[model samples]
Target: MTPADLTCTVLGAVRRAVEEGALGGAVAVPDRVKVERPRPGGSGDYATNAALRLAREARLPAREVAEVLSAELTRHPGIAGVEITGPGFLNITLAHGSRDALVRDTLTNILTSGSGYGQGRALSGQAVELRHRAEVRAAVTADAVRRLLEAQGALVRIDAYEDEAAGPVPAPTPAPGPAPTATLAYEPSPVPAGATAHELHRRFGTDATRWALLRAAAHDRPRLDDGLLVQKESNPFFLVRYAHARSRALVRAATRLGFTAGYEEDAAALGDHPALLAALGDHPAVLASAARLRAPDRVARHLETTAEAFLGFQHTVLPVGDEKPSAAHRSRLALAEAAGTVLAGGLSLLGISAPEYL
Candidate 1:
């Protein structure tokens, strides 16, 4: 299962424990639970610290909570095993069928949703007002954040403010929905001198300019060097776009070889691409978390990680030389297509382009 799916499953286990009095009624369930890759020397496909987080409310030791939740989780059809590690971490492994199902679901969602694949309703019914300083970097950062918030179903309005004296203007209640969460005046670190909006557009063009500004956290100074414009491996911006292009290229080559993208039911037939699969599965969670945190850099970093994983796995997507096409090739091609869709969708959120030709 995807990371998001596993998170929900874990959360559900918590809820069930609470209801059944295993965790006690006083133990409150969090709105979301974080499940991530296991740490080095850790076991299982993914790990979580939910038990540790809920230990106090449950009035039990962290390991006890973990054991209780483990009982509930092991009953899940998708979960093959759940192990409690040091200090009550839940390390989970999915059933083989669940892993294959994740591949099918991830590809289907990306293909069906197209550019809207990672968009979620986590912020649905919330209204947000963002006012940024009259600086290029601030404006760009605010724009990217606006896109992320809107993608998560927030009704967002943004404008520039030249004077800090113009404090947060009281927002009018949005029509028939939840009230505004808060009015935020976002004043991110300014771009260095000579990186004016117009100059950046002229120097790096829209794609590179946005990438340079959005790749870093809002509070940090951006690197507006010529390196961002370089089309080499050293440039992360180049690597991201190039990976998308490579994914598309693989598709074209597969088409010429008289085969198209397809998902495989058997995990063994899909070969060992755990890292790539995990990256793809984590896209939705990354987008949701990025939106919640108002950090587009999280999305940017996720795209970079996904791109890196996809690039490393690209060579296997198509047959080499006269090697005949098979189900494995088709499955690999589908995975590549999903990665391309995610790269394209994320770049669009950052106000950048994922050109088919890098």
Candidate 2:
């Protein structure tokens, strides 16, 4: 199950305990339960401090409250075990096959949802007006903000001051690769360093230029150098785009081997790749925060994190040499594909390209 599902399960258990008089009805149940991946040296696939949070309201010691909730939690299916750790934290380990099942379900949802995986209506009916100076940084930042706000179902109108004397007006450079399916209204601001927009476009291309513009915080000057064009891990943009490209390459390799992605139920096959799963699960929350905070850097940073996790997991994705394709391979491929989807969606929101051949 996703962390979200586990959270609901815990909340339900708490509610049931109160109803059964196992815990006092006066206990103030929280509006939302916070479930997180356990810290280093901690037990279980997930952990929560619900017991500690509800202790005072329940009129019980934290550990005692944990024990009560743990009893109810252990009754739930797919929960292999629950341990009451230090200070009433509940560490939960899923059943033997549950991790793989959860990964499979998550990947399936990502693939089926396509670019809409993390899209939400959190800002629905909210009209956001973004006004910015016509500087390169401000224009790019505003454009990205517009996309992020729209992603969350907000109606966004971006207006820019075109005082050329204030700064160079950014020139409209065509995006790289194919035409974008959905176009946002963006008036390009002045090119950085008094260079013509065409010169910058020729130097960095659409993807790198946009990444260079949006990766840094708006208050900070972006690094607009040849370093961004490097095809190595040191470059965050390259790492993210390369990771997405690698995932696409895996799909091609798998197709030639006569198999597509299939959900697996073997826990051993899934192994210990909790980091990638966690990154995928946290994507929706990241998107929401980025939209609310008007920070495209959050999305950029998230893509980097996702890319790092995918890189660590990539070697396990497909069969190597004499190894035959197995359920594990298919499962890992699904995970990789989901990672690519998130990377592409996030890049799209930043008005950057996620090239399949990058």
lDDT agreement with native, every candidate: 0.82, 0.79
lDDT (10s digit) by residue, model 1, range 226-295: 8988889679999999999999999999999999988855777654777777777778888998988888
Model 1 quality (TM-score):
0.88
Could you tell me the lDDT of residue 158 within candidate 1? Answer: 72
How large an RMSD does model 2 have?
6.6
Q: Backbone collision count in every prediction?
A: 0, 4
Query: Per-candidate RMSD vs. true structure?
Result: 4.1, 6.6
lDDT, candidate 2, 31-119, per-residue tens: 99888878766798899999999999888999999999999999998798999888899999998667767776777889999988888
Instruction: Report the lDDT of model 2 for residue 95.
Output: 84
In angstroms, give how far residue 109 of model 2 lies from its true place.
0.6
**Residue 345: error of model 1 in Å?**
0.8
- Name the best candidate (by TM-score): 1
